[model samples]
Target: MPNSPLHDWDLAPREAIALQKRLAGQVEREDRLDPVGRIAGVDIGFEQDGAITRAAVVVLAWPPGAEGEFEPTTLEIVEQVVHREPTRMPYVPGLLSFREVPAALAAFERLEVRPELVMVDGQGIAHPRRIGVASHLGLWLDLPTIGVAKSRLCGRHREPGPARGDWTPLVDGPDDEVIGAVLRSRVKVKPIFVSPGHRLTLPTALDWVIRCLGRTKLPEPTRLADRLASRRGR
Candidate 1:
């Protein structure tokens, strides 16, 4: 796996969080490049021993429009990284990005195709620090990215209407500043958490995610990465 200029395994847990917070404050909330070209997704899983960590990255050439299905001609890459199996990080409400970012970065390094944008299966600026795994990764890579999470991490929301495409703003705090959105990507299915990861806005992230959705619950790139990562277990 490629080493990140920002990574430091020697740092204590508290120091890591502080480093992440410090880095979070420096990210520019502006889209520096267009992401209508290729896209990638990353995911990580563990081996039976739980001491070995496996990560997979899948990059697909995405054309424009709903008909522009993610081509199966993806560059599927995988790698195994050292894992110490530290006690699961405390469910610190808004800091999961810290727990998972390291593994995700390892997976990202195995990618053969550098995508224009990367959609991570985690959070983004929708967190308490305005930075999550997606944001952290994007900043590190200097690439546009978005977070498409399966579960809500932090933020409040009114249940979206019972229909596909229905959504409501995700309130960050008491002031209700919209941080993200609860989008019903599929009818009758639980909503997906859509947030701006880096170099993109919440609306742009949602638009791209919707464009990438197919006849499945998750986006194509993410779904592909999940399958590829799972296959390493066998």
Candidate 2:
């Protein structure tokens, strides 16, 4: 079940920051997911000179393909939905959910086939407020989500080895708390940051990301969603 109006969307940056702190406490830090059968990719883009926010959700069959016969190019798109609306909140650093998530929730509501697990193209708990776009979306949608960001938003980490699957701990705070993982999704590519969004653990989040990886630096789920978003943005 999805969340029932967690909080208001109309607020100033200061109000939004306060909300993030309150919501951060409710975020589940342990694994609380069911058996996964379908997976979805959630992505956001802009159009009309950043006036229109475009969100995409692409649901794919779980287990991708038979063993090593996996073909990301031919993966079945069980369902796809796109939503666009006037930008609700302007771009605010460390406040991505406030800017991009209103339309994302709308897109998910339009999906005919709901996904059991989701891969989002943004930050999760690796944000300053501990609530990034993926975590925010998961709280609203009530589905397991992982943040698979192309770049680091917060925290620090050691360099991962230059090989597929090599990863290092992304830590924060003076005590060195693990916030996420810096992962080498593909060889000769920059590392991606992986973090638990909701209803999942860090290890489980990392494991699913590795399973969904395609030939590119991104996993199959978010990779396809990114392509779909780019085409629609034009």
Candidate 3:
């Protein structure tokens, strides 16, 4: 069983925003974990039927060196929950965290191995309020997490170099207080938006994401979770 109390379709825009604001204040930044152990990736997919949500969580052991790669084994532990309520909230630019977190949390509860850190397929503190889906989940679980979004959400930065591994800081404003980094994980591939979700710093988040990049554009955990979620929906 998972710990999700509300469904995606059940929340109104105003109610969801208020709930996020309430949760944002509860974030405990002092107890962040330094992830030297296992790591997990979480993603959610909705069935075309629009009645069911499938959440997938994939765990991969860490500490892979420069040449090492992530060979994630699908854990047998998996769970699915249904939300019969219709999705009332329309797609909004900054409020996506509310749309996805419920299903993500459901999948996370079924993980047999607790990961020291989690990477979500969305934004983190790089968001307008410094609270994206990754940040929201980190606050709820009190776990160190990072947001590895496929597209740029907010902020400005220089384009990374043509070569892989080259990166530039993502500044939140003219003062140059770095909120995250635009990392070139793979050559000729679009850079991923990496931001600290909770407990960890931007530098640490970038290092972990870079290390986890295997033979693909996305990190192994996120890639695997995405695959599973997409497949399960079919």
In order of appearance, the predictions have TM-scores of: 0.81, 0.93, 0.81
**Model 3 regions more than 4 Å off:** 1-4, 7-10, 25-31, 49-51, 64-90, 174-176, 232-234
**10 residues in a row with least lDDT, candidate 2:** 65-74
Off by over 4 Å in 2: 1-7, 69-74, 232-234
Model 1 CA deviation exceeding 4 Å by range: 1-10, 64-93, 232-234
Error of 2 at 54 (Å): 0.7
Q: In model 3, which range of ten residues has the least summed lDDT?
A: 75-84
Kindly list the per-residue Cα lDDT of model 3 for residues 1-234, writing each as its tens digit.
144465443567777777777776665444368646778888766666655666677776665433453322332222322222233344587788766776676666665668888898898888776788899888877789899998888899999998777888888766766777898878899988898898888878887887777767888778778888777433
Cα lDDT for residue 1, model 1? 17
Measured on C-alpha atoms, candidate 2 has an lDDT of 0.86
Top-lDDT candidate index? 2
Error of 1 at 146 (Å): 0.3
Model 1 worst lDDT run, 10 consecutive residues: 79-88
Tell me the whole-model lDDT of each prediction, alpha carbons only. Answer: 0.72, 0.86, 0.73
What TM-score does model 3 achieve against the real structure? 0.81
User: Each candidate's root-mean-square deviation in Å?
Assistant: 4.5, 3.3, 4.4
